[model samples]
Target: MDIANQAALVTGGASGLGAATARRLAAAGANVAILDRDAAQAKRMAGEIDGLAYACDVADAASAEQAVAQAAAAQGPARILVNCAGIGPAARIVGREGPMPLADFEAVIRINLIGTFNLLRLAAAAMIATEPQGPDGERGVIINTASVAAYEGQIGQAAYAASKGGIVALTIQAARELAARGVRVMTIAPGIMATPMLLGLPEQVQQSLGDSVPFPKRLGHPQEYADLVVSILTNPLLNGETIRLDGALRMPPR
Candidate 1:
């Protein structure tokens, strides 16, 4: 679907890949709404892009519902919903510190897996209510963010990997269910991107991680991920699959 003049909602748009996607969508003439727990950062980014900023905890039903409603009120029902709000807390089931707390694992699942489904359901419902835009009767597109950890998780990433893996599974099923309604669903499993978390590591460590990539030999730029999102939005045929953006690097156990 053409992005121009359409409404789009990007979760976790305050920073990292979500921020880049928000800017790209806005530049393409979409009315963008940034949803993030960081209200100040969301406001700042929204100002830069001339979009709306909504403080939202995507895991909470009430918060997400309110944010989505507010966004629709400001722009229109979002035809493009991007789920990028997630957490990455590394922990093993059992460690020298003892078995991981059940709450810790549940917390990751709540924010990453359930949160994604929450937004998808709410946004798809809104999209379905809107009239179709293109020949495909395409009411909307939903893009989800997963991680390569879902494929090759390191030793300490059980919780993080499980959450992301659930997202990957949800993508195809969602696409299938929403297909009849002309709403597309896709997932992007990012490799090691040059986000704040990786940037916080020492330069040498970061370089070593980059070197692990078979090609490109570098961490992915947020803009690169954003570019793919634009492609997914524009190309209606690219649905029901999780594309890995990892440059062919299969992570080893840490």
Candidate 2:
């Protein structure tokens, strides 16, 4: 669909990939809304992009619903929903600390997998309400963020990998279910990127990570991910797919 003057909602839009995507959408003429748990940062990013800012917990049902409602009221129903709110804390399921805390496992699943679904369901329903636009009877498009860990998880990333795996697993089913409603669902499984989390590591570690990529031999940029999102939104044929944003790097077991 054309992003020009369209309503777009991006979760976790305060920083990293989400922030980059919000900026890109705004630049492409979409009226964007940034929904994030980090209220101050969300507002700051919104101000920078001249988009709406909403303090929302994507894992919370009521919070996501309220934020979507507010954004719709301001910009009309959001036809572009980007599910980017997630956390990645590394821990083995059974470590020296003994089996991981059940709560820790649950937390990752809650914030990453369930969070994506929450927004998908809510936003797709709203998209259904809007009249179909564009040639393919497209109501909207939903882009979810996953990770390369989902496919080749290292030793300390059991929970993180599981959460992301669920996201990748959801793509085809979600797209099929939402297809009749004119809402397309797709996912991006990104490799190591220069997100805030990775940027905080020591330079040597960062260089090592970057060098691990096969060809580019560098970390992926958030803007590159945003560019893919734009392509997915505009290309009517892309749906029910999980495109890997990795530089042909299949990770090794840690």
Candidate 3:
């Protein structure tokens, strides 16, 4: 399907992978709408990319619905929805402080897994009405974000991994259910990417982390993730699959 002139929405578009994907979609001639909690930064990126920006909390159904509605109001129904709004705060199920706070685990699952579901549900509702495009009758495509932690979850990644694992489970089922609507669902499970969270760490710590990746010997660039987004959006055959963006980095149990 041609992305040129199509409407696209990217959640968590203020920074990190979401921001990169937004810029890439804009460059591909898509009319992009960026949704993020950071209104100022999202607005700034929107100005730079000539796209629309909305302040949104993906965990809240009402917030996401309103935000998606705002995007559709500005630029018809979005043909592409990329869910990148999530949090990854690591905590052990049982720690020196005793059991991890229930809130901590809930927060990760709420924002990471539930958040993806919120936006996708609303976006797909609107997209199902969109006139089919291309020979495949493609109405829309949804690309969900997961993490390598889902597979080789480190010691403190129980919450994050569970949330991501749910995303992986949802991909194929969502694709099956939405097949008749001409909507494709897919996921990307990235390894150790040099996201803002990691970049905020000490320089030596960052280097040590990068050295852990087997082949590339470095953390993934945001642009590389963005490139894959472009490929998945344009390729009609790719659906109901979780592509690991990790550079063969099967994490050690730390």
Candidate 4:
């Protein structure tokens, strides 16, 4: 699917990975729409990229539905949907504070896992209805963001890891189900990327984290993730797979 001029939707596009992706897609000639909870930031990014912006809470069915509909109204139905909006506050299931609040765990699951599914289902339905493109009759592509923590969750990442794990598990199943509709589903499980949250740490701490990577010895760039998204969109054969953009880093259980 040559996404040039095609409608694309990116959640959490205000900053970090999603912002990078929006810029990359726009640069590649895609008509991009950014959906985020931060209305002001979303507006700012949209203005920068000349794309549409919608205030959306990805976890809410009504909010996501309204935002997707509005985006389609402005830019046509989205043929490219990327789920990048998520949270990752670390907490132990049982700690000195006693078992982590059930609400905390539920919140992560809601915002990360269920939120991803909300947008995915809406976007996939819209994609399925759109006229297929290219010789393969491809209708659309969806790329989701997960984390290496899903595979090797550390001591205090129970909620965050479980949320990402759900996304990882959903990848193949979604791909298999959407394949017949000419929709491809894939996932990127990043490791220690230089996202804003990570970059906010002290310099020495950041350096130490980067040094843990097996090679390159640096944090993954958000642009790299965007590049992979472009690769997945253009390649016809890649589907039902989760690619780790971790530079060969298999995390230890901290």
The lDDT for every candidate, in the order shown, is 0.95, 0.95, 0.93, 0.95
For candidate 2, lDDT tens digit of each residue in 31-106? 9999999999999999999999999999999999999999999999999999999999888879998999999999
Question: Candidate 4's residue-wise lDDT over 1-254, tens digit each?
Answer: 89799999999999999999999999999999999999999999999999999999999999999999999999899999999999999888899989999999999999999999999999999999999999999999999999999899999999999999999999999999999999999999999988899999999999999999999899999999999999999999999999999989988989
Candidates in order, TM-scores: namely 0.99, 0.99, 0.98, 0.99
lDDT of 3 by residue, 28-100 (tens): 9999999999999999999999999999999998889899998999999999999998899888899999999
In the range 38-86, model 1's lDDT, one tens digit per residue, is: 9999999999999999999999999999999999998989999999999
Question: What's the lDDT for candidate 2?
Answer: 0.95
Q: Worst 10-residue stretch by lDDT in candidate 1? A: 128-137
TM-score of 3: 0.98
Candidate 2 residue runs with Cα over 4 Å from true position = none
Question: How much lDDT does candidate 3 score?
Answer: 0.93
Candidate 1 local Cα displacement, residue 124, angstroms: 0.6
Q: Count of backbone clashes for each model?
A: 0, 0, 0, 0
Residue 57 of model 1 has an lDDT of 97
